[model samples]
Target: SDGQMPQTREHLLLARQVGVQHIVVFVNKVDTIDDPEMLELVEMEMRELLSTYGFDGDNVPVVMGSALCALEGREEEIGVKAIDKLLAAVDEYIPTPQRDLEKPFLMGVEDVFSISGRGTVVTGRVERGNLKKGDEVEIVGLNKTPLKTTVTGIEMFKKELDQAMAGDNCGILLRGIKRDDIKRGMVIAKTGTISAHTKFLASMYILTKEEGGRHSGFGEHYRPQLFIRTGDVTVVLTF
Candidate 1:
């Protein structure tokens, strides 16, 4: 646990922004404290801080432990036992991923490479559905029209596979598609399914330097550079 560090709060805010569903707080450095009353006070302070940030601090699992004890080769100092408890909590509380193999296949093209004599190979993490050998898929991205292609093969860790499902990071060989058309940020899915976002509306926080100066008073028609999902794009703000 970070106790009451500014960086800890900032990191938690970042996690919230990025759609984190669950959080497991491990309160470290319990070995340094000799007084039980002082340790309880620290936990109470941490809980208050968490509650101030709109979290269920009292309800959230806060496991106390000491990594220093573990590093010093001590097992009875509540070091490894705390870690074991955390692991058990994770398995008991955290929900497993619910992947629907019935949904249409979707995978974003992250990196494209040309394997010698293997045609155009695209690597990405599957988002939904299943992709099998000889499955027909479409490429959509880079502001270009869609092109239909077939999945010649699927591979994970150099092992050839007949199919891949959601959450699988694998390379796929597309038949008849050239490497020139393959680009990052492209979506590979069933034809007529992929939709590329053209506009974004988000509240931008002045995180870095808000000391003495507030956000820029750009009232209307403010044009700004937007760092969007995996790419940078500029957009005009219509007030």
Candidate 2:
């Protein structure tokens, strides 16, 4: 399934709750606003919204683009230029995490599905280390003993790849594992890197809404979807 785009403040908050250290905000529809001052005000509002969502306004990179116009292919030159600028900003600001290849590989499963003849296929962005075709990996948190399975297939960006490195999103085909054994929100790691826990401790600040009684209760249960790494889970919050 295609990943859902976050809409509300809570949705962005949920993204942060998952393990998103860096965020890129693309403010589309700049072509609609003809006034410069009005555009500045909109930009300010965007920054404020991001700050309210637990992001540093100065740190988080925001780009102005028109996705709709770009798709229509009317103003091709302007659209391509805007896209290039956005790509440059992303490359400059987002710091890619360094991975230790020698260390154990841990991939948090973000998506899972079944194939016609290939059986179960799992896809996730690799957080650390490297995984190669024909290599054996253990599925943690699902079973007690590490089930040794061969990497039947691997793909990166629609290209058939022999291996996947850290920070690269990949789809993998397993040999022995059944569809019932593999589940979304599970981590495929090298033996012992992932630890399963029933409870976790976290520090969170409640974002105040424009409407006054939104966050009135200090200890109310807040159940929001949590995305950590490539894993998505529902976290019950008490604040």
Model 2: CA > 4 A from native: 1-25, 40-63, 76-78, 100-102, 142-147, 209-214, 218-226, 232-239
RMSD of each: 4.2, 5.5
**TM-score for all predictions?**
0.71, 0.70
Q: Please tell me which predicted candidate would have the highest lDDT against the true structure.
A: 1
Model 2 lDDT tens row, 1-239: 11123355666776776777777777777777677787667668778877876788867777776777777775654466678778888888888677767777878887888888887888998877898888888786545555667788998878989889887889988887888888777888865566677578887655556422254644557678786665667778764
lDDT at 89 for candidate 1? 80
**Candidate 1 residue-wise lDDT, 1-239, digit = tens:** 33567667777666666766667777888887777887788878878767766777787677788888767768555688888888888887667878877889999888899988989999998989999998899987666578899999999999999999998999999998889988877788987777666665767655543222235566567766765433455678874
Q: Estimate the overall C-alpha local distance difference test score of candidate 1.
A: 0.79
By TM-score, the best candidate is 1
